[model samples]
Target chain A: MLTAQVLYGLTACVIVALGLRGALLHASLLQRVVAINVMGAGVFMLLIAVAYRGPGLPPDPLPHALVLTGIVVAVSATALALALARRLHAEQDND
Target chain B: MNTTNLLVFDGLLLFSIVGLAWASLATTDERRSVILFMAFGLVLAVAWGRLLAPDVALAEAAIGAGLSGALLLAAVRKQSPGSSHTHANPDRNYSESGAKVVLQWLVTLLCAALAGTLAWALLHALSSAPHDTLPRAISDNLVASGVSNPVTAVLLNFRAYDTLLELAVLLTAVLGIFSLGQTTPGYQPAGPVFDGLVRWLVPVLILTAGYLLWVGAHAPGGAFQAGATLAAAGVVLRLTGRSRIGLPDGFVLRIIMAAGVGVFLLVGLTLLLLGRPFLGYPPAWAGALILLIETAAMLSIAATLLLAFVGGQPQSTAVNAAANRQREENSRC
Candidate 1:
């Protein structure tokens, strides 16, 4: 069971790598946005996966709350990024 | 099949999550990638649940899957007419694509090696960090706090400073969005059928948001979840054209967006003045004070999210009339 938990952490690590690959090699800005978000999700998984030791324990509430805060921050950042993209698109349309 | 074999389920879920993310990011079609991204968000909710953080699962589903998906769709749609993707030409650049394929392989190898090292450390090494240390402290102090939920206590009590800064961060993002563009139109009004659906859904959403906020003190819900739920309702109304997305700049709008931080400042300062060390409320009054802070936070979060999505103030009356005309014509067809 602990090995399963470690596997989950490894999966998260892979997800982050996939995201980094997308962010770097992709030509599209939208793809980069998607990639960055995927990386954020992996970070979340890693944090929670590490905190979760076994089934019956109370689990770490600190990371849960921190993840919640992080999610909100991530959304705020996403909104700003999308707005920037939208502005650029509109300008291109006008031209 | 052993019904309680959670490890099996966990393995499957991790596979699907990684696969879905890969498809979403690797696909070339803009619309299809976004659709896959939305599915990825829902899977994220399930993953958080498996991790035993239902509070996060709820927030993730609403904000991550629901709102973010809708926001991305709207942004994509805004560029529908003669759209220009970042990679404007593909077939013309065969050599460029070939070079990119080589670079991709190298990056993948590097990332895999890094992940393997971390996995080994987590499983075999990394000793002596002390388990249950902070948890003991939190539980020891939990009774004195008004709420029994450890997570809620920590967020609003022990580490209130972090939550306070998060509220400010949300505010700053909204303001940064406003500076990006002034005339960007917010939402598109679909047909009357969809409009009817939105009308029926809005009230139910508002009620649920309130219930979630009230339940957060001792349950797996809180201001972020409640606020995100409320923001989803506002987004629906905007899409239906029943609500204004780009309502003009005014006194009311400004105050509502900044209200969360304002209330946080007042609460913390009041506690400091009372000689209880900033944000340290009286033992007996902590519960009531947290409830109050959460209520303001919920309202402010909803308003801030709406503004951030809209990006800027409404355009002139003439532009509004043109949009209305366009909607009417599209619906007729």
Candidate 2:
């Protein structure tokens, strides 16, 4: 169980870094949006890892609930960002 | 599972997750990248399941992987409006200049440092004996929280204020999308085969959404999962060229979008009036109250997600129906 936790936690950290690199380096707005989501997923994964107790024992419900809320928030944020991007594209077409 | 076996599975899952994320970001093409990201979400969902978070896994599958993929794909289609097969990505060769390459290296180093710091801190935290206080507290109060499921109890009872605020955030997002502009012209009507599929798929999705909502009080399902499932039905309907997507426009749509937050606030205030703390339900009434809140929340979540997928406020169905009739008459002429 400890091994699983550490592995996932470390993996989450790496994913977050990769996402940050993409968000900073990518030129396009859409790619940046995708990068941000990847970062959010990493954070969620980390929370879930922290919440894990053992193979049979029920994990911490607090972090589970927190990650659930985060997922919804992340999707909404993605939607809003994509809307802004689309509006920008429409405006650019006019220009 | 034994330690070694579990370790191998964890390693493989983690490897695939990181690979998928990297591949998704590395691709320059928007459609390819979004598709890869969706695949990443699915794999991450599996990881969540492996970590023993069935609720989170279900949500990741529905909202994270499914609906978000649909939204991103729709945005990609809009980005390259003229053709289904888009040309090479405009952002494809970004590392040409010397200055850009130097910046890229610097940024990469910074991210690596961030990852190293996080991992170091995580290892230190894990090395210490685990804290059992909070989890113990949750289990103690689990019965009082009114739901048998600890996660549901936390979301709906113990930490309900957070859930309420989360609903507000969702509402804020949909409102932002609506303010941007009208929705894109919808898809063409589905062909016969797809139409038949929709007939079967939509009903099953709706049934599942209802089942998830009811099962949430005890199991791994809840308002968010149920709401996303319901929204999937709407998305399918929208994709099949149904402009209305079963949504009543104007006042009704606004109400549905606001329902989650509105119901939550109303319940909180009512409980306060009854001399309980905000969102603190009496133990005896807690289960019923949570169910009430979850139902309203389910409706609001479904509306918000469907609208977010649609990308903007839709025009009323009346105008849309009249336009369709006019077009039909013109074709006859």
Candidate 3:
């Protein structure tokens, strides 16, 4: 019988697998974004697992802060990328 | 580990990733793919929360998933329908040779093996470590910072210097965007109805942002999170045409821009005067000082980010109209 942690680990593995597949197989820009996001989610899940220390240990707060910062930075980067993409599309349309 | 719960969570995460991969692989339409990508971001946010990193989860949801999704969707809307359908095939010039296929497989295998090995090592190290120093330090210092959340202590006290630098990075990003000169060009001016909406929403957003900032002293909320929310509201207003993009170089703008850095610098100087180390918070006043600095920092950051998103010169009316129109369309859809 697999424990919850083990099952969660499996989940993280599967998510990573899917993210790699998506990144490798997909060519569409939006799809690439989706693949990256999926990968990010997997990494977050892994971080969560690391933070989980038995039943009594206080949860890790550093990871939480780091992840929060990561999320904000990720969004800002993505927004910038999307803006660039829009401009690229516009330029292509004109061309 | 409970086998059933583990299995269920594993299944959910696997299914989500696979679904995202399938969507990415199957979709030829760039627009749809972008939407799917945003969905993937949201799911990832949920996963982060489940992992016991609530702060990360909140940030991911608001900034990563929410803001990015909005930006992407806006970009998509701006694109001409026909341009979105064009697909650039990478393998177009490549001959379908056996050697190429073999090379690809070999590369993939190598990458996977390396990743697997790295993960295994990390897992082993995490499980076998005799003592975790980082968590202990944070817990010990949590009360001194007058914050219940150890994460807050780490961010604001133990590593306040890092937080200060991060704010600087944010300011630089805004400057970079200004140099781009694309400031809110696509956004239209707002109408009378839009003004009414802004009047109702802006105060509420400001109030929420204030509460979030104050609670961050002992809770999950903080300056970055609150600033982002405030910026979101500003972005909304800019999009709707209620708020124009000014030079952000104006006197007020300059002050707001410097406020975070200024407060940080002043606080460090004040501590130095008291014979404490630079960036060290004094025992009696750590909470009060941190809150004061953070409040200023939040305001500065919020304004800076919003200005960055809008591009350059603040054009209030046109941008607001466009934002309002877009919001109405989004709500309807």
**Pick by TM-score: which candidate is best?**
2
Off by over 4 Å in 1: A91-95, B1-4, B82-98, B124-130, B186-189, B243-249, B315-333
DockQ in order: 0.65, 0.78, 0.43
RMSD for each of the candidates:
4.3, 3.6, 6.3
- Give me the runs in candidate 3 sitting further than 4 Å from their true place: A1-38, A54-57, A79-95, B1-10, B21-26, B78-111, B188-200, B239-249, B313-333
| lDDT per residue (tens digit) for residues B1-333 in model 2 | 688887888878888999999999997778889999999999999999998999999999999999999999999888887766543456455688888889899999999999999999888888899899999999999988888999999999989999999999999999999999767778999999998999899999999999999999999999999999999999999899986687776898889889899999999999899998999899999999999999999999999999988888886677567757865775676
Pairs with steric clashes in candidate 2: none
Q: By lDDT, is 1 or 3 better?
A: 1
Q: Candidate 1 residues B1-333, lDDT tens each?
A: 353587788878888988898898777776777788889889989988887778889988988877777767767666565564434246532236667667667877887886777677666542435377887889899999889888889888888899999999998888888788664454557798998887788889899999999999998998999998888887787877554643335777788777788888899999888887989889899999999999989988888787766666555578668868866775676
Candidate 3 RMSD to the real structure:
6.3
lDDT of 3 by residue, B207-306 (tens): 8889889988777788877887888787777667544432254677878987988899899998899899998887779888889988998888787667
Q: Rank the candidates by lDDT, best first.
A: 2, 1, 3
lDDT of 1 by residue, A1-95 (tens): 46546777888888887887677766666667778888888888887777775676777888888888988998898888888887787567556
* Chain B TM, every candidate: 0.86, 0.93, 0.79
For candidate 3, the per-residue lDDT at B73 reads: 58
Q: What is the C-alpha lDDT of each candidate?
A: 0.79, 0.91, 0.67
* Pairwise TM-score winner, candidates 1 and 3: 1
